[model samples]
Structure formats: C-alpha cells, structure tokens
Target: MHKTRIGRDGPNVSVLALGGASLGGVYQDVSQGEADAVVQAALDAGINLIDVAPYYGLTRAETALGAALKGVPRSDFVLMTKVGRYGDKTWNFSREATLRSLDESRARLGVDYIDVLQCHDIEHGDRRQLIEEALPTLRDLKGQGAIGRIGITGYDLSVLEDVATTEQVDTVMAYCTYSLQDRRLAGVAQRLGRSGVAVFNASPLGMGLLTSKGPPDWHPGHPSVWAAAAEAARRCEALGVDLSFVALQFALQTAAANGIVSTVVGMSKPSNLDRNIEALTTPIDPAVLTAVEAALAPVRDKGWDVLPGGGGKAGK
Candidate 1:
C-alpha cells in the first residue's frame, strides 16, 4: 500500500481509495455484513480513504460503512461522504438541507466529523447555486469542526476547475471523466494539481468495462459499459496484458490521476478484492501501454456521448 498527498498541502492518504457506492447496492446487491467485511478487508490492506454518498442506495451505503468503522480509530482512516442528493432522488443544496445532510451522515457513519464533505453531482447551471448555497454551509461546518475539509464530486471539468481555482476545497472526486477512454479532464487535473486540490479519480474501471470479464449485454443503465469492455478486450489482445489489470493500472499510472477511487468490485464474489489488489501492485510494461493505446484508438476517436463534465447521462 502506498500513500499519496491528499491536497497539495493536505494529509497523506492511501494511493487506492475504497469507493462505498457498491457497498450500498448499486452495482451489486450486498448485505450489511458483507459490506462491513469488504470495508474491513480494505482497512487490513492499508487503504485509508473511503468515499460514499447519500445518493448511493439512499444512505444504506453510509450506514453499512458506519457499521464497518465501529472499531477503527477515527484518526487511522479518512472518511468522506456527499450531500446535494437525498434518498428520495431529489437534489437540494439549501443551507438547511446541507447542514441536515451532514448531521445525518455523521449519525449514520457514527463519526464525530467527516474528513471530507462533498457536494454530489453538481452540474452546469447548478454549479453556481450549489457553490453559493452549499459551499457556504460546508465552510460553516468546517468552522464548527464538523468536517476536516470540503469538496465537490461530479463530471464537469469546467465546474471543477472553477471550484478548484476559486474555492478552498481540499479535494475533488471526479468520476469516469479522465480514464484511458476519456481524457477530458487531463488538463483539469494539472490545473488542480497546481492549485493544491487533490483529485480522486473515481470509476477508474469505467464502471466495470475495463475488467477481465467482457461487459454483459444486460447491465442496467450503463450502455457504455459494453462498449468500454469491448474496447478493453481489443486492447488486451493487442497488448498481451489482462484487460482488467490494464484498466486498473492505466488509471493508477495516469499522470493526472492522484489516486484511483473505486467501489470494491464484487459483481461475482469476494475474491475479486484480492484480484483488484493484485492488479494495483502489478507492474505494466511500456510495450503493453503502446498496444493498449493503439487498440483503443477507434473508441477514442468515436468519442463516447459522455456528459459535458464527464458523467454519463442519467440512467446511462
């Protein structure tokens, strides 16, 4: 396990962060006990950062994470969660709602204060209002010692750039935006890096497309999953490297990516955690990188109908 600096001047954190979305039951159905076990495994593996959101399984994920952190010392790990979206699928950035959301998250995670509190999925026009309303609330929370740092999570590079340039957010959790398949945020990462905002690259596997297993036909809501898998398969064949390993390594090796933050990919079994951990440590060759880029040229040229900020459309 390696550690990376969070913000330019922030605390050190594990190079790989455990994403709590899967623990809440979006990608695969996982029970509380199973989720807790997964969290425990991540901790044992020396992972320190865990990212979750209220939008994931409507707070179920946070609750499961809370249960998992019961015995762990608060100082040993960095806990992060998001506001903006509620369990009922509504986006609210009101002052009251933001404060209430933090309080609820603290209660659910059983933490005195969150290490990082982010605004979830803020986009185009919504960015200004969210900043105006939500950011002030978060700043107040930081003042009150309710959170250690502030952040915003979404796919919009411009908004993130604005936030990173203007605000004092310690981190930015940007998902599926700057993977090998999508490089829209490459410049954003550089800008934020210079600005001292830690950038956590989320969905590094493109939501399971870059794994060894080919994308299934029936994966709900994620049409790009299949396309990404096919592209990864072609790359694997050309590069003579396992697709899953390449995907994971590509993210880890990306110049703009500070660290890879992804859910414990458990579509099939628990052993997948070991496999992912192995991929993180495995060394990749330069020839393999060239082959992968060549194989992915077509998909890259096609340009996925990705959201402007890098998130897929709703129900995509």
Candidate 2:
C-alpha cells in the first residue's frame, strides 16, 4: 500500500485504509480471531490508517479493534474514530456529551490519544450544535494532546462541504459517494482539497450494492438503482469476474486521480484483506470495466438522502 499526506500538513496514511465495521460484525458474525488477523494483516501490508466509530455496532467496533491492536505498537497505524451518533437514532453533539464520548471511546479502544477524531454523521446532528459546540470541543482536545487532528464524516456531500469549508477541519469522509454507481464525491473531494482538507472515500462498494451478493435489504438506494446494480453483478459473474473487484479498482484509481487521499473498506478476516490487496495491486481490465460501467449506467450518480434502512428519497 502506498502512503500519502493527509490534508496540507497532516499525518501520512496509506491509500487503502482498513475500516473497522466488519470487526464489529456489521455485515456478519466475526470471531475475535478474525478481527486480530485482519488488523495484523493490514499493519503488515503497510496499511497505516484504521478508521472506526462508536456507532458501528454500538461500540463493538472500537472494543474489537482495541483488542486487536493490544500488542502491536501504536505507531504502526493511524487510529481514527468518531463522536456523536452512538446508535441507530441516538445523536448528541453537545460540549459535555462530546467530551464524555471521547473518554468512553478512549477506554473502549484502549488508546491514550487518537490520531484523528471526527464528528460522525454531522448531518444527523443539529448543525448549529456541531459548529458551535462539538467542533470547538474537538479543537480543545487536540490542543490538549488527546487527539491529533479534527475531521468530519457524513453521507451528504453538501453538508460535508458546508462544514469543511466553513470550519477548521483537516479531513472529510463521505461514504458510498465515490463508488462505481456514484461519482459525486470526486468533485467534492477536489473542492475540499483546495482548502487542504483531505477527503476519505468510504464504502467504495456502495455499502454492498456493488457486491455479487447484492446490497443488504436495508440499503436505501432506489429500486431502479438496485436493479441496475443487480444487472451489473450478473454481467460480471457471467464474465467470471467479481463485481466488487471492479468497483474497488474503479474507486481507488478514480479517487487518486481526483486528489482523494484514501479509500476505506470493511475487512474482518485475512482473506478479505487479501482480496482487497489484490484489487489494489492488480491492473483493471478495460473491457471488463467498460461492460460493468455500461451495465451500471442506468443508475449512475443516483442516490438517496436517507441513511440505510431509513426509507429516504430515491433522488437527491
């Protein structure tokens, strides 16, 4: 894995960062052994960035990741986690809540300091509260050496842009926005880059929509979008290729070309890490990619405003 500087003057991180969602069993049941293996594999492979959040599995991710990283030298990876949005509908961005969340996360992750402390899903919290209370509190923590940098993550690009441009943020993470079916985040990442805000592209698989198994039933994409993804997956399978490989390849390549710093994906086991590593190292077949893109054209750039399982609108 190759490393790049985050923001204009932030820490250097690998381009293919490992996400902690799978460690928490977000997609399926994962054993403690699997979590340990994946974390070690990522570190050995030079993947220096590991992203997680308290909301992922309701603090399970942080707990699992903390155990996985127990013996490993902390300097081996850049640890990142988020505040607010503790559960499906729980959101608190107040000053006191933010501080308490940090302490709880630190204890859960067994870390003395975090590399990047982000405001998770800012669009879900009161916008004024985030700008007026949460963000300022993070800055204070940074000054005190509890956190290294400040960042924000959300599903909506406009809200991410609004906060990143107006606030003193070092990075912005937008999930499912820069995948094969959607390229909206590329433009937003470029715009944010101008201001020295490093952009992270999470869920390059479109939260499972691009996978061969198809998205989870809770995915909020429109019916048409799901149909198109299903068709694309069929075509890929017919051609004896994995749709996820093409999606990951396209996302990593396109993100790099557009100035995006990293692409985060969930990997709970070593086999999962191996497949993703292959996607990063292998050369994409132009003909196969062309076919996949054509199959996905019907829903290109289409998305929903609501989070997964929220039954949000089909179009933004």
Cα RMSD for candidates in order: 3.7, 2.3
Candidate 1 segments exceeding 4 Å error: 87-89, 212-231, 234-241, 255-270, 301-312
Q: Which candidate has the top score in TM-score? A: 2
The deviation in Å at residue 308 for candidate 1 is 9.0
lDDT of 2 by residue, 1-316 (tens): 7899998788889999999988888889988888999999899999999999998888899999999999888888899999988877778899999999999999998989999999998888888899999999999999999999999999889989998988969999999899999989989999899889999999999888898998877778888888899899999999999999999888887678887999998998998889888888888899889999999897788877532344442121
Q: Give the clashing pairs for model 2.
A: none
TM-scores for every candidate against the unseen true structure: 0.85, 0.96
Candidate with best lDDT: 2
Q: Which pairs of residues collide in model 1? A: 155-309, 156-309, 221-316
Local accuracy by lDDT, each model:
0.70, 0.88
